[model samples]
Target: MDDAASIDGDTTRPLSQAELDALTDQLIDKLKTVFDPEIPVDIYELGLVYKVDVSDDKDVAIDMTLTAPGCPVAGDMPGWVEQAVMEIPGVRSCKVDLVFDPPWDPSRMSDEAKLQLNMF
Candidate 1:
């Protein structure tokens, strides 16, 4: 039997709405464990993650950004996000989409993140 079937006793049952939400939450939590290496705060709290999409097939796609377009870690940040998201229990594949549409600013950061950086 497949892993999903083993977990729920039926592979055709399909992941319920609650299960999908739970899986998304799990992936977010794992993302919180990842850092930019230069920033003390997790990328999530820093307002880096803009969106997360999980398909019924267990694939996860993340849209995110960095503090700066020229940030030295640009090459590695996406990889970090992909790795963290992949650690989620039900994710079969992970992809990170880097975006700079609105641009990142101090306002995008969470209160906790601001406090950590002494921005207030």
Candidate 2:
């Protein structure tokens, strides 16, 4: 996913669909590295990530949530996610927002996460 918007000289242009797609893949890969600490699966697979938006300058905004409102690491997980996303080369900035609008449910977990947790 390092290939996303990795232009040689001009980086000020608005992201093309291809660049956005590649950047999205990179973002997902980075998100996959962040875990809930208590869960064996990463946050991405757990479906904690709600939305991701990338700016023309490569700034990233993410909306995510916890499995439970009272989760202990609630104070630290967003920072972890932001840090991970910032590791991408072309990313100028990263911001992670915690949201509970729809809340989280086991139904949100990916098939791989379900298999990992034996939810099936």
Cα-based TM-score, every candidate: 0.84, 0.89
Clashes of each: 0, 0
Candidate 1, superposed: residue stretches over 4 Å from native: 1-14
Q: Which residue ranges in model 2 land beyond 4 Å of their true spot?
A: 1-11
Number of the top lDDT candidate: 2
Q: lDDT (CA) for every model shown?
A: 0.85, 0.92
lDDT of 1 by residue, 13-117 (tens): 467899987997798798899886788999989999998887667888889999999999998989988888877776789999899988988899999999999
Instruction: Quote model 2's TM-score.
Output: 0.89
Q: Per-residue lDDT for 43-83 in model 2, tens only?
A: 99999999998988988999999999999999999999999
Q: Locate the minimum summed-lDDT window of 10 residues in model 2.
A: 1-10
Q: How far is candidate 2 from the true structure (C-alpha RMSD, Å)?
A: 5.7
User: Cα RMSDs of all predictions?
Assistant: 5.1, 5.7
